[model samples]
Structure formats: C-alpha cells, structure tokens
Target: MSQTTQPLHFARQPHPSPVAPEQRAELLRNPGFGRVFTDHMATIRYTEGKGWHDAKIEPRGPIPMDPAAAVLHYAQEIFEGLKAYRTADGGATLFRPEENARRFQKSAERLAMPILPEALFLEALDQVVSIDRDWIPEGDGSLYLRPFMFANEAFLGVRPSSEYLFIVIASSVGAYFKTQADAVSVWVSENYTRAAPGGTGAAKCGGNYAASLVAQAEASRNGCDQVVFLDAVERRWIEELGGMNVFFLFEDGSMTTPPLGGTILPGITRASVLALAKDKGITVREEPYSLDQWRADAASGRLREAFACGTAAVLTPIGTVKGRDGEFTIGNGRSGARTEELRNTLVDIQRGRAADPHSWVHKVF
Candidate 1:
C-alpha cells in the first residue's frame, strides 16, 4: 500500500483504428449503460517492491491473463463507478471523483488489495476522461467511468498477490433504467442476505456483486426492479438494495438511512444526499430501520417517501415494495415531491447548472 515511487506518469498509446465519426455518433445515440466503450483506457502496474509503475493510457483492449492468476482463484478484485457529464459550457466535469478515489482505497483495504494512491487514482481517471472526452454523450447522458484493480500474479496462492494491475475505462451511458417510470418497484429478500458483520460487504469488489446476481434474478422473477436485502442477523432490519443505499423520508420532514457499520458500501452519493438534505433544512438521521417499521410507517402514512441512492442510479424512488409477507406502497406509489426536489438539486449541481456550494463537481475538460 505504501508508494515507493514519486508519482505515476502515464504513457500514451492512441488507437490506431479509432471509430469513425459517423459510426461513433450512431453508437453514442444509444450507448445504453456499460455496453459501449471509448477508444482508450488507462492502465498501471503494481509489484510487491516497486509500488506503482509503468503507467499508460493506451488503446482500449484486453490484457492476457494466466489461467491461475491470483484474481481468478482468490477473487481479490475491486472496482469503482462514477460519471463525467458534459456541461453547458462545452466542457466535461466529474462528480466527486476524489471521493471515489478515497472509497477505492477503502475497498482495496477491505479486499486485502493494494491501496492505490488517491492522487494517482484521480490522475488515472483524468487521463482517461481527457482522452475520451468525445465519448461523453449529450443531454442527460454521461460517460460512465470504471476504475478497477485485480491481482494478476499467475499463481494459485491463499495469500495476497505480489503483482497487480489497475485500469480505468469509460463508457457512454444513458439513463440507468430503461423504462421512464417515475418510481421503481422493489422486492424484499428474506431468504438471502447481502452482507454480515466483519465481512467484505462494504467493499466495492466483484464478489459482493456476483453474489447478489441470484437475488437480483429473484427480484426480476418477482416482477420488481431491484431487490432489497435485510440485516443478516435479524432478517427484518432494512439494510440496502443489491447495489444501492436506502433512504426513508418521513412526513415530519426528516429522513433516515441505515448507518454505516462495516456492512454497507458507504456510498458517495448517499453522503452527498445527506449533506444536501441538511442544507435544505431537512433533518437527516443515520440509524437502523427495520422492515416491519417501514411497512407500519407506510401504512400509517408516516413514511412519505423511500428511495435508493448510488453512483449509477443517483436517486431512484421506491414506489412499491413486495415480499412474501405482503406488499406496500410508499406515498401514492409515485415519485414524491421531496424526492424530485432532492434529485433535481443534486442533478443540477452535477450538470453545472446550479450553485456548487459543496464543490462536489470536478471539471475534467
């Protein structure tokens, strides 16, 4: 985790056969989510004694991997997701990328992976965005940035790998949800748990996501947009969605979210929403919320709104929730006014269309 080198200097290797402008434009018209990629990517190597070195921004392609790479066997991999938006000023900006960098460090620590320097992390993202700026879509679209690392040492071992690879890739994406629904329906998962105490649930690793796939599929089968996981111990306390954090808004103009107790991802957007809520004079609390209480409060008209927040979706209102026990709807089963207000406020700042009192947006171009 210690850096023996001064700083990373990325070498450039432009794409020999970059996508033609007409084809790129056609592709950008519907880049979807993570399906479309830019022309180049940022990469760096880490060794046991050399720290980080051989950094480069090269043509987008694959790196050959040995069959027994440590990452393949041990699953020591971490990743981060953020976005770069095209502002009205004809430039691109990133939303709280430094926060992503810090969280990446924390994820690395939890996964027993190498701690990439925060500055180097930021620089890597900047280089990737700077080179692939054209890939950024217009309107509500954005360039999704994915920063990842994995153990590459070609050995079958139980301990940490001495060699690793870090890379950054970008994709042009539209709305996360394919549908234009005002709110998304959710399914409560009682049979499966997303995380437990002293586990890697808080980490942004591949394993946690891979484990959630089955539950997610269950949600899909149940006719829901996302799956909500409860606490492993009680199986009733509301924890989070498969990939997002949860928030409960009360009629008393207050909101509460599950506290970060090493079982949640500690989302960057979640923190920003809390700060924005406080700024708007809404009382915000970080505490435990039980599923039973959520149902009761919703039924009693105390819970005005509920939403999920994450880097990808930003803020998605939870209109209806269904489980084996029963089903419940939040506040008319539509996006609440307060929810819209909060999302608009956050999006305005992200798109550089409003005041940035918190300085969360970083200009990349």
Candidate 2:
C-alpha cells in the first residue's frame, strides 16, 4: 500500500456556534485528557458492494444510526489511538501513524471486517488533525485522535454486517497523569482474565477493553490505579495492564518484558522502546516473566524498576504490585533512573526537542 495521498473531497460544515474563546480557554487550562472535544470530526463509510467511499470531513456532533445497529447488538468494532504534536516551529506532526494504520488493518481482519486502505486511513487522520490544528495545546499537551470503525448495518443475525462506518475525532488533551509522573499502584486480578490463548487478545477491538473494565474496577476498589492480568492458563505469568504494556529493568543492565504470546496487544510504544533499548546498547529480552520471579527478583535486588507504556500515558512508573496475598514495592517506591531516562528520551523525540533517530515522526501539514 502506497503512502501517497489521493485528493478525497470532504464536505465541511463549520459549527453553527462554536464554544467561545473564554470558555475554550477555561477548559484548556487543564483539559484533563479526553474530556473535551474539538468542533469537527472526519467520517467515511463502507459497504459490501461499494468499498470505502463517501469520505468527508464534517461538523463534530452526534451520529445518527438505527437502534438495531450491528455494533450495538453483535459488537463488531475496532479502533486506534495516536497523537498529533505541535512542533516548536508551529508545524503539526503525527507519531508513527502509519504503524497505527497497519495495526488498525490487523484489528479489522481479526474482527472479521473489511480492511481500510492505508492511504485512506492516513488521509482521514491528516485532514482531521489539520482542520483542528488550533485545538492542539502547548507545553506537553496534544491533539488526541481516535479513529474507530463499527458495524452499522441494522441486522439481527449473528454474522458480520454488510455496512460499516469509520470516524476520526480529535480532542484537546492535557497530561494523562494529572499530577507529577509518580508511580501508580497495580493490583493482580485473580478472578478474571483479560484474554485466552486463542482469543482476540492481540486485536485492538472494543470488546477486549470492555472485558477489562470490571477487573479495572476491582483494582480501583483495592486502591490501585491499574490492573495486571495474569496468563489465562497458568495464572502466574504477567501479561499486561488494562490498557498498556509492562516492562522490567534489571540491576545487571538488562531488561525484559512478557513476550507476545498471542494474548497481548502489540503496542507501538512497546516496539519503539525495544528499538531504543537496542540502540542504547542495552541487552533486551522478550520472554515470559512470571509473578514469582518478579517477587523473587525484587527481593534479591535484581529487578530495579517497572513501568507501563502506552499512547495515553506515554510512560508511568509502577510503585507497588498488590495481590490477594500482599504487596511488593519496587525501586524504593519511586520512578527509577533507567525508567526516567527512557521516558525522557522517548518524549524528547516525540515533542521535537531531540532528533528523531528512528524517523518515526510524520509531518501532517
């Protein structure tokens, strides 16, 4: 699939009455991530007979769909998350968005849906971000972009629907971590599993996150910020968090994380971190690190730090890991040096402060 752009005409409509500047400023003061939205969104449609067509950039508002939509009943859906950065030179750029497009196609195939062409997906995202460039905030803020597709055909059968809709929305978001980037407490989910061996665990489908909400709630009740799901079969190996991937840095200058065992999301951030680690001459291992090993290593002073990475939180240090039995503290209960180094390096590259050695940044304008 070529990355060249095709001139797809968009039907535009300015908001009849956009939020006043003062009101918008007040909201942007904190933004609080994903709570506030821009005034416009991009949309497109696809059908069995007609491929992806009727692409348009329209006003930001509610969508009109039938009550018996396939998404509501059968839950056939997929989505992707990426950010648009406001460069120091006032240029707008996207972070590895082509990777997101490829992942979205994989997600569609897993959900038994039609794959959106790479060119079409990238064009939609570019148009949306460019139109809403004013909404991109300053000082570590971003224009959070969500591109999702759902089965829209009004059908009741258990088969895949013939009609589908893909839409991209932009939201002005502040830091995902409200305060300082402190370590978050994580809980071990004993009663539930996020995915099975031969399940849709790796796909970025809505159902996988939906299934994790309860476990997340359980973690919250236990005074934790996120839930760590164990392997479905053994229930001993660490898998991933509710929405991010996990990593561990050892005292011997080596690091490791759980391997992609067909039950974990292949996060773009995770892949980038691995590449960065290799470039930095750090020995990295992708293997199954179990809970017992985590506790043993922490006690033995071999495990130095633990953190989770994703598009939303960029990077967050893990302070404590608590389960039914007890809790384990890591790195003096704070973000460690190695963790901060990696986080800062990645963020610097992303926010245009440092050179993007990986050529991961894509200029949107």
Alpha carbon deviation, residue 277, candidate 1 (Å): 0.3
Top candidate, metric TM-score? 1
In model 2, which runs have C-alpha deviations exceeding 4 angstroms?
1-7, 178-181
Residue-level lDDT tens digits of model 2 in 1-365: 12223445667766778777788778778899899998888898887866777888888889999999999999999999999999999989898999999999999988889888888888899989887787888888899999999999997999988999999999999877654637888999989999998899999999999999999999989989899999999999999999999999999989998999789999999999999999899999999999999989988889999999999988899989999989999879899999999999998888888899989998997
- lDDT of each residue in 244-292, candidate 1, tens digit only: 9999999899999999998898999999999999999999999999999
Cα displacement (angstroms), candidate 2, residue 272, comes to 0.6
In model 2, residue pairs whose N, Cα or C atoms come closer than 3 Å (at least 3 residues apart or on different chains), thus clashing, are none
lDDT of candidate 2 at residue 272, scale 0 to 100: 91
Going through the candidates in the order shown, the clash numbers are 0, 0
How well does candidate 2 score on lDDT at residue 59? 81
